[model samples]
Target: SSLTPRPTGGISPIALPVLESLFTGNLQEARKLVFSQMLVSGQAAENGGSNNFIIGKRNQRALQVLSKSVDQDNCKTNALLYGGMHCKDLHRRLESMGYVAKKTEWRTAWSVD
Candidate 1:
């Protein structure tokens, strides 16, 4: 899925809704729910006979950033700001992955290995 756009030097819009959902509900509970969803969804995919393809290097870095930012101690505001930083990092990572194609094409989508 495509990441949502963030304001320049700010949080991505995609994370905002998640933050809102976390706050309006129980944050830890929400995390547990999301984790469960990921697990169950992954299992469903596996049961459907999907092969476990290696994640592209760029995606691995992105996941790392996400994991670090969305820790249990981080609050909504912290997470929002962290996600902003992570999005910028992801941009650089994607560029290094050759997905940016050209320096001028950073905003456009490109293929991964």
Candidate 2:
């Protein structure tokens, strides 16, 4: 038998700023944040050689699961835990599906003083 780990969500940590900007009514800032982070990640999405295909696949699967779960009458709340780079797009998809963000609670994933 073998154990394998599958991607369950986006893995970028920079989504914090993008999300913050979005929640604060700054769509331009959020787009800039996501685009800059994309460049920094070397995903050069504007070029055809970019490797976001994998990410797109993972996000699609995750969204499918989220949508199905949300449609369940017994399911009341859900969380799409993904990294910051992936958050902006995922947020848009969720919004298109009629999900409204009620609030945000941030916890420090790490810190140094």
Best by the TM-score measure? 2
Which whole-number lDDT from 0 to 100 does residue 66 have in model 2?
79
Q: Pick out the ten consecutive residues of candidate 1 with the lowest summed lDDT.
A: 77-86
Model 1 Cα lDDT, one tens digit per residue, 24-113 = 876765575566567657655653222322223444655556556656546343321222223544565556655443333234232211
Off by over 4 Å in 1: 1-21, 50-113
Model 2 off-target regions past 4 Å? 1-49
Candidate 2 lDDT by residue in tens digits, 31-108: 778776766666444323344555666778999987788776557877678764566667777788787888877765
